[model samples]
Target: MFALNRKNSTFNFKKADFPKLYDLLSKVDWSEMTNVKEVNAACDFFYNTLECIFEACVPKTSISKISRRSYPVWFDSTIINCLKHKARVLKKFRMYQCQRHLDEFKKLRSQAKFLIAKGYSEYVKSMEDTISHDPRKFWTFIQTKRGKSRIPGTIFVNGEAISDPCIIVNNFADYFKSVYTVSLDNNYSANMTTNNNILLPKISEDDILRQLREL
Candidate 1:
């Protein structure tokens, strides 16, 4: 929390100010801080919130399918909708993006061992930390196909889109395996249109850009 201010060859308050600074500022009108802090807080929440969500919503067996297909749709849709109001605030604060803080949220997933849980806490924590620190080779959200039991998907650098027809069938085919030979497209199309603005069919536009940058 300390950084040199080149302008004055001195310390800057943003980093230098800590406990006392926060206490003093506590008296000021921080009504806007709620809106302001959420700028990147949404992204941070996405990283952390989704961990528990995946564990609870997705079974261990089906996670892989969800990760490869349905997850992108669910994750993006969940995040975008959950943070719709925050996105607006972020837009307003474009001039003052706290890249450092925003960047920190980007690492929350890697720290999932402590933040999240599984049967194996230690090993998963180590792996999660490593992955969270690096996005190019790590993806925060992941899942397997939906099923009775399973942790289907593990986060990775990349995977199949949630809406892919191939993914749909591979994951959910069993449910319809006996019903019909209908294409997974029917499901994909229906889900996509239904979730539109509320939930995305894939990862965020920003993550795509970051991935592109790495390439």
Candidate 2:
């Protein structure tokens, strides 16, 4: 079960009174910060004043912990609309208890199921078709479904499990150094000096603009 669990604090910036906020900010004596010699104290005073003004002008809302199931990449807006319509139909059937509403609800329910299955099938087919050429897309989709970071919580070295982040990092550095370290023979050093003496062509502004346009 892949789920996301977190809480966030947000403010409705769209609903804020910009005029009042601007007026309050303009009224603040910013010159007072200049009198403070320490840069940290000046920054603290500025931040506190802005925070107070923001709190007075805008309301803060806290989002409760959200535990949501991960949806597939194939779940598009069409499927969303179908599900919403199905829900509305079900609500109508329950409220009216009419035969017509019940029939409509059943029809929509079947349609929604069919659409979902078809979407998944198409998604799988596309992945299979492109796996040979673009395997990254397939792996990226798998990672999305996993809904967790790729970083591991523990690393093992020489059959001993190490969980300390600093030790794990040092182990990685040592392993990489062992793998990449190269012996500097006299010939290799001479070849490197020769390569360093070779100058490459300079790139112009037009070349950069052309590259940006292609991107």
- The candidate maximizing lDDT is 2
RMSD of 1: 27.0
Candidate 1 lDDT over residue span 58-96, tens digit each: 333211222322323223343433344344445545656
**Alpha-carbon shift of residue 214 in model 2 (angstroms):** 35
**How far out, in Å, is residue 12 in model 2?**
8.2
Q: How many residue pairs collide in each prediction?
A: 31, 0
- What's the C-alpha lDDT at position 83 in model 1? 47
Could you tell me how far off, in angstroms, the CA of residue 90 lies in candidate 2 after the best superposition? 1.3
After TM-score superposition, what is the CA distance of residue 154 in candidate 1 from its true location, in Å? Answer: 27
